[model samples]
Target: MIRCTGVRHRRLTIPSLAANARQIAVIGPNGAGKTTFLGLCAGMEEPNKGEVTLFGRKPSEVRIGWVGEFPDRTMLFSRVYDEIASSLRFRHVSCRESDTRVHETAALLGIEGLLPKATDELSGGEKALVAFAAALVHDPEVLILDEVDSHLDEEAGRRVADAIKSRPGVSVIACTQNMDTAAEADLLLYIEEGCIRHAGTAEEVFEHLKETCFYPAVWRVRGC
Candidate 1:
């Protein structure tokens, strides 16, 4: 769980947390600062003015597992198994435990077969699974996934959804524009111009969204 007080960016200002959610989905047109807000929640970036905390620790002080829109940044090693194991190693988990943890996470994600392949050898979807595996290997308390669903196809997308629901001990905060994706979230935040303009449960957000002024359908379906 996270709470932000006195957050400011450019002309945007939020005196207190307008939204609090265990599973949050942020949506808005591009440049709305959805990514920026996610970064702040994940402690990947700092708020120029306020305090943000994860389980009571400062944003930067808390340890979190993150997967970005781009899966390429997930690697520093050549092999998939090593890449997944790096988080454990960095946290000083014993070598034996690291291997065990990596195997467990990969198996759960159904990507254990890719363990032997080189990082560059995996397809985009395959690499995405690897990135998620790496993040889960440590089992951090919070997981920040930035538009990860955008990289997946239908079947793979379902698998990602199942993975999120099955995983335990982590609060997920995903930034996405997919209504299907938002439906799976416990909460939804509409970020406009670097601040939260509206927030509610998925049903509430969608209902409000249908009644309010916003732009460019999230998915652009020919007929919805």
Candidate 2:
């Protein structure tokens, strides 16, 4: 479970919020503090007040996998294999085990063929897959994605959605502008002005947004 109580940082504020769903989508306008909320959840930023916890422990104490909008910026190693193994290496996992895990994660994401290639040689979509492989190699309890699908093509976006589905045990918190993608999440958080205006299942949240442009176009067309 992920819980936030009296969280206040910068322009974002949450008096109370708890999420136990396996997949939660954060949707909002460009500057609605979606990333700020994700930052707090990822432990990348400490809240100025209150607390954010994962499974009863502070978020900082939990193992989390994070993939941001630009994976290249965070890519530490040039080689794909090395990049995927970086986290395991930092944790002092045996080289053999790390190698096995890296290959497994790459294969899981259907990026094994690119493992031997240099990161710089890959395309943008391929880079995102590699970054995802790196984040998933360590089997984090929570996976946080910040608009990772924004730059991806349809195929790449589908691959990301499939990858998330493949890891049902890991709680996924993704901030995305794609209403269709957001509609697929188990829960939705509609944030605005640094506050969550709505939080519920897709049907519930979309009902609240049905009159607004934020509602899924497909749903609107279907009158759903």
Candidate 3:
């Protein structure tokens, strides 16, 4: 659903990225350009060097839901319900449908009780869930999540993972340090420095990890 050719921004350079999988995981070390790469795919940032296209259109023109590493960046409204409902409201969805979608999305992320809470009062993990809910409510064709589950606990993380996995038509490209989450993805891309060092199945990427001496968190998650 997405393609990048010689995509470069700042220090990162992805020679090529042809992501056709419905669920793709971007696993990499700190400062490995994972977020930069995601921004290119989301059309949030334009590459100074190459091209990135999503679903045959520019990333900005495509319908996509994105959640960044920081939840606060995604927050605009003060209330949780309004935050999740914002997307639907922007599209002029009926109030009844918007309300239903808001509540349903909150419930899916196990944050039903939080619907009445204030956005500023939520914990970091809670805010993350809210941010994710906001992205999911509109049912965008592609979901770009940049290390969104980092602050979430194991259960919350699984909830997020399960929710994304259940979406039949939405393609997801998540950048995560959580190897267990990466392991569940349909495809894996291992990035280092500013390049995609390897792009393949989980096993194939892990094989490449075996050759490296660092043995990062992803390797630990794989019991390597």
Candidate 4:
């Protein structure tokens, strides 16, 4: 479980959103502090007034895997295979097992052919895949994603969704802008002005939000 209290980032004062081991989705308009809130949850930033925790443990106490919006930044090694296999090798995984894990993740992400290619040479989407491969190799208890779909098309997005669903015991928290993305979410949070206007299942919040927020009316209801 992760928690935030009196969370303030720069000018945004976010309320404490406690995640008690369930999957959560954060959504709202751009600049609504969704990413900032996620950063705090991921322990990338210190809060202005409150604290964050993971199951009564700090983020350091719990292993965290992340796929940032720009994945190329996570790449360090010369070759894609090296970048993917680096952590596994560091953990002393057997050579045969490490190769198998890397190839398996690559095939799952459709980047197997790029194993020998330089990490510096892959496209943005391909780099995203490699970064994802690296994150999943260690299999952390929690995965935090920030706008991971920016560069992906619909098919790529589905592949990611599939990967997320098949995993077990790993809790996921994500910040996204796509309403369609919210449809796949089990728990959805609608944030407005850095506070939660609503937090519930995707259907419960998303359904009513359309009626509450003002939009150009298409037709007049029978009310006069």
Candidate 5:
């Protein structure tokens, strides 16, 4: 579970929130504090006030996997295999276990073939896949994504969505502009001007946004 109480950082604010859903999607307009909320959840930045916790512990104390809007900016190793193994190596996992986990994670994301490739040589979509493999290799308990699909094409996006579905035990908090994708989450947070204007299941929250462009296009076509 993720909880926030009187959380405030920069322009973002959350008086109180407790989310136990497996997948939580944060949707809002540009500069609406979506990324800021994600950053707080990922423990990338400290809240100026109040607290944020994951599973009864401070967010920084939990094992978290994070992927950002620009995966390239976070890439460290030149080779894809090395990048995926980086986290395991940092935790001092044995060589044999690290190798096994990296291979397993790559296979899970259908990126085993890219393991031997160079990160720089891969295309944008391929790089995103590699980045995802790196993040998932260590089997983090919480996964935070900041508009990761924005840099991906349709097929890559589908692959990512499938990969996320494969990890039902992990808590996923994603900030995305894709309403279709947001609609698939277990819980939705609609924010504007740094405040969460609505929070609920897709149907409940979309009821408040049916007249807005933020309504899922698929729902519109279905006359929902």
Candidate 6:
């Protein structure tokens, strides 16, 4: 869970985004502060004004897993299993436990067969999933994914969705451009011009955006 109030950093301003929603999907055009918002949520960056809290504590004080838009930025190991286990190694987890967690997380993300592959040789989507597995390996309290599905195909996206849906205890906040993916979230946030234009159920937000310039015509015609 996360909460923010008048959070401002550079050109972005989040009036508020209440916590407690199980899964939140943030959607907006490019440079709409989606990534900035997630960074603030995960404590990757500081806001010039206002406040941000996760699970009743500041973002920096909480345990959170972040998978950025670029997988290569997070992948340091050559092997898939090693990449996922790197975090556990940094935390000084036992070798046996790290191995178990790495394999389990890979299987959950439908990438178990890739355990022995070379991380640098993976496809774009494969790299993303591996990065996600790394983030999830430590079982952080919250998971924040920033446009992680951008390069993923439909099947890959489904696998990501399944992994998120299966993790009930981990609060998820995902930012994406895909309307269909946003539609599947328990809560939807429509941000425009660095502000939260709407925050509610997916249908409610979609309905509010239907006739506006923000909603994609293709998705609107298909009835999101």
RMSD of each: 3.0, 1.2, 2.2, 4.3, 1.2, 1.9
For model 2 the TM-score comes to 0.96
Q: For candidate 5, write residues 70-169 as lDDT tens digits.
A: 9999999999999999999999999999999999888877789999888999988888888888888888899899888887888878887887778877
Per-residue lDDT over 30-131 for candidate 4, one digit per residue giving the tens place of the 0 to 100 score: 777777777776778877787777877767677777788888876779999999998888789999999998988778877789999998898887787778
**Clashing residue pair totals per candidate (backbone < 3 A):** 0, 0, 0, 0, 0, 0
The residue-level lDDT of candidate 6 at 117 comes to 94
Ranking by lDDT: 2, 5, 3, 6, 1, 4
Q: Which regions of candidate 6 deviate over 4 angstroms? A: 212-224
Determine which window of 10 residues in candidate 3 has minimal summed lDDT.
210-219
lDDT of each: 0.79, 0.90, 0.86, 0.75, 0.89, 0.86
lDDT comparison, 2 vs 4, better candidate: 2
Question: Per-residue alpha-carbon lDDT of model 1 for 94-205, expressed as tens digits?
Answer: 9888888898888888888999999999888988889988888887778898998888888878777777778756788888767767766788888777667777876666
lDDT of 1: 0.79
What's the TM-score of each model vs. the native?
0.89, 0.96, 0.91, 0.84, 0.96, 0.92
* Residue 210 local lDDT, model 2: 79
Cα lDDT tens digits, model 6, 124-157, are 9999989888988898888999999897898988
Q: Tell me the TM-score of model 5.
A: 0.96
Q: Which ten residues in a row have the lowest lDDT in candidate 1?
A: 215-224
Report the C-alpha lDDT of model 2 over 138-222, residue by residue, as the tens digit. Answer: 9899999999888688887777778777887898999998899899999999999999999999999998887787999889788
Error of 2 at 193 (Å): 0.6
